[model samples]
Target: MTTWLITAEETVIADGAAPHRQIEIIRKVHGNKTREEALVELHKAAKSHVPDSLKGTSRVVGRDSDGSCWILPKNGKGHPPCVIRFVEQIHP
Candidate 1:
């Protein structure tokens, strides 16, 4: 079986490779399925899954030209941004 893993990550700053950067694995969703089904499921989960870092406050969604997804504070309520991605894995 193949398991699709949706991983969401959060950082103290925008730069992933910044020195003294704080990184956190905020959320992950997984499902076992074929490639086509897993891709659909993982995409849906990525678009809809809320990160643990910003659960209670209001938020907005943004998409970069390079296809990065971001979650931000709706009213500048001090919530940090979150970025997510999905990956496919195979298992016996």
Candidate 2:
């Protein structure tokens, strides 16, 4: 089994829009699956697993291997409200 750390980070942007949250596979290890497979599983969990308090605004959905992220309204699609880019990846 792979150990994965899915992080939901919330931030306030300069656009005056509502606060946003992004989810990513911040740390993944010990799995034989490809990076894509790991991400797919992580995204599925994220879709319905947000905490109650953060559910109102956090819409994290997609993440690239490079760690870029996107958010959208529940049940909506295309054109994210904003992007939560990766600051850095820590491999320790």
Candidate 3:
């Protein structure tokens, strides 16, 4: 299975300030994969779980040195699975 690291952040909408608490998760998927591919899968997976109001605002945050993508929810608060999810590589 492929390994992925996920992190979460809580931010304020008024000032666009720093996140309140950041959480991290390490998960395994089907197999080895690239960061981009993993992010796509993560986005797909997260889309369903995200609230309808916040769905359009979700976005991938950053990439770690190891190439793992940090997926984060934007424009709101209280996001679940607030970390990273892994997926198989489909292309270069």
Backbone clash numbers for all candidates listed: 0, 0, 3
Q: What lDDT score belongs to each candidate, Candidate 1 first?
A: 0.59, 0.50, 0.47
User: What are the per-residue Cα lDDT tens digits for candidate 3 across 16-61?
Assistant: 6744544333333445666677676665544434432245675545
- Per-candidate TM equals 0.52, 0.39, 0.35
Tens digit per residue, CA lDDT, model 1, 1-92: 44556556675534465633344433343545665565455456556767766788777766655444667777876666776655654455
TM-score of 2: 0.39
Candidate ranking under lDDT, highest first, comes to 1, 2, 3
What lDDT is reached at residue 6 by model 1?
57
Pairs that collide in candidate 1 are none
Residue 10 accuracy (lDDT) in model 1: 74
Q: How many angstroms is residue 74 displaced in model 1 relative to the true structure, after the best TM-score fit?
A: 1.8
How high is the lDDT of residue 1 in model 3? 46
Q: Candidate 1, overall lDDT?
A: 0.59
| Candidate with more favorable, higher TM-score: 2 or 3 | 2
Error of 1 at 32 (Å): 8.9
- lDDT value for candidate 2? 0.50
**Could you say which candidate leads in lDDT?**
1
Clashes of 2: 0
